[model samples]
Target: MKKAIIVGSAISVIGLMLVSCSSTPEATTTTTRQTTVTAAPPPPAQTTTTTTHMSGSGY
Candidate 1:
């Protein structure tokens, strides 16, 4: 009975150690993207003109 208990304890401890020391899987791929935008042109300039008239007779 004592030998059976000792063997069982040893097996349990070895199983726990194996589980703790195992390696896990990881991701190895990466992705990236770039974008561009265009702006509109400015509006054109404006011009104005004025005229005046005079009479022959004075007040």
Candidate 2:
């Protein structure tokens, strides 16, 4: 009968869908390790100054 044929087709289609959906395994992402670098300290700060004199004051 047409009804039986339709039912059989529907069942077959559902089985095929489930098989296709679960046929392949999921892929996982790989992580790369990270590296850290440390830098050396900077040199100390320095400053110099000079004094000025006027033409003839006892100073």
Candidate 2 colliding pairs, count: 0
lDDT for each residue of candidate 1 in 15-47, tens digit (9 for 90 to 100)? 999887785446667666666776777667666
| Residue pairs whose backbone atoms clash in candidate 1 | none
State, as a TM-score between 0 and 1, how close model 1 is to the true structure: 0.39
Question: Candidate 2 residues 1-59, lDDT tens each?
Answer: 99999999999999999999998878869878899877878777766677786677766
The local distance difference test score of each candidate is 0.80, 0.88
How far residue 48's Cα lies from its native spot in candidate 1, in Å, is: 64
